[model samples]
Every structure is written in C-alpha cells, then in structure tokens.
Target: MSVYLFFEKKLPFREKKRKVVRWIQYVIEKEGKKSKRINIITTGDREIIKLNKKFLGRSYRTDVISFPMNGGIEIEGEIYISLDTVTENAIQWGVTTREEWRRVVIHGILHLIGYLDNNRDEQRIMKEKEDYYLERFPE
Candidate 1:
C-alpha cells in the first residue's frame, strides 16, 4: 500500500508524510479495502476547477475530487484537494483549517472507497462516516 502526497500551491498544511500515509491506511483497511496506489494532490481553486470542468463537466470550484483508477480489488485513485475551498469551508463551518482539511481528505478517500453524497441521506451517512473516522484517527 502506498499513499503519495504532492503539492502545487504550497498551502500551509501541517501534515507529515508518514503520519498521513498511516492515517490513510487506517481508513482504507477499516473500510475493508486494500490500497495499492493512491495519489493525494493539494492545489488551488483554479486547478481543481479546471479538473472539475474537464472530467466531471462541472464548472465550479469544489473542495476535493476523487477519480478511482482501479480495475481490480485494490484501490487506486487520485484525490485532488483545493486548499482554498478547504480554508473557506473551515471558516464557514467554524473549524480549524487543519480539521477541515483532514475531513476533506477522508471524504475523498471514502468516495474512492465507494461512498456517495449525492443526496441528503447519502450526505448524512457520509458525514457520519467522516465523523467516525476523524474521531478515531490517531492524532
């Protein structure tokens, strides 16, 4: 299992490589999925918006997007996170930027793990899963 972290906008995120990878592994294994390759890229709004338009046909900014690239059992995907949106969401939700960032990261991973939030019920369940994973994450 490998979780690769990359940066484009150089956001002020307090994450270490080892710890973040372990946290990702914990979530994946607990969800009954094995990750062979996972890429987490942190960028700004413009880049994510471009991806949203190109791949998803949405011309708006989003916090994160997950693209599953696996054909077998192992999970392989790319998660693009927009730090600008994450920051704004943190302020809007009255949480620290780091906290919101963590939530978004897990949210993307859950998406790659077959979770959805297209409706109210799915959003609630997804939020509950995020809360469960975040509460159990080792700080």
Candidate 2:
C-alpha cells in the first residue's frame, strides 16, 4: 500500500506529508478497504477545471475530484485537489485553509472507499464519515 502526494502549486500551509498518508491509510482500512495505491495531486483552479471537464464532463471548479482506477477490495485511485478552491471555500465556510484542505482530502478518500454523496442523504452520511475519521486523526 502506498500514498503519493504531489504539489503543483505553492501550498499556503506546511503539510506533514507522512502524517497525512498515515491518516488516509487508517481511513481506508477502517472503512473496510485495503489500500493499494493512492495518488494525491494538489493544483490550482484552472487545472482542476480542466480535469473536471475532461473526466466528469463538467466545466467548473471543485475542491476535490477522485478517479477510481481499480474496482475491487483494494483501493486504488487518483485524487485531484484544487488548493485555490479550497482556499476560497475555507474563507466562505469560516474555517482555516488547512482544515478545509484536510476535509477535501478525507472527502476524496471516502469516495474511493465506496461512499457516495450525490444526494442529500448520501451527502449527510459522507459528511458523518468524514467527521468520524477527522476526529480520530492524530493531532
């Protein structure tokens, strides 16, 4: 199992890369999915918009976009995160940028583990899982 993180844009806060990876691993295992490989790419809004358009057929900016590479017991995927959008969302949501970044990361991981948030009920459940994992994250 492996978690790779790439930063395309200058991040506003310092990230404990190893800690984040461990947190993801824990979340995957806790959710009953064995982690195989997960790639996290942090980029700007333009890149995220392009990816969203290319993969999801939507031309817009989002905080996170997840692509499931393999479907099985093992969790494998690419999670693209838009730091620009995260920052904007943090300001609007009254949360710190780091907190918003963590939320986005956890949200992507949840998607890879078979959690869906397309509707209100699913979104609420996903949010609950995100909160559950976030609360357990080592400080």
Number of colliding residue pairs in each model: 0, 0
RMSD of 2: 0.8
**Cα misplacement distance, residue 136 of candidate 2 (Å):** 1.6
Clashing pairs in 2: none
Query: What are the Cα lDDT values of the candidates?
Result: 0.91, 0.91
Question: Compared with the true structure, what per-residue lDDT tens digits does model 1 show for residues 66-125?
Answer: 999874558999999999999999999999988898899999999998889999999999
For model 2, residues 1-139, the per-residue Cα lDDT tens digits are 8999999987899878989998998888887789888999999999999999998999899999999888778989999999999999999999999888999999999888888898999999999988888788787
Question: For candidate 1, what is the lDDT?
Answer: 0.91
Candidate 2: stretches off by over 4 Å: none
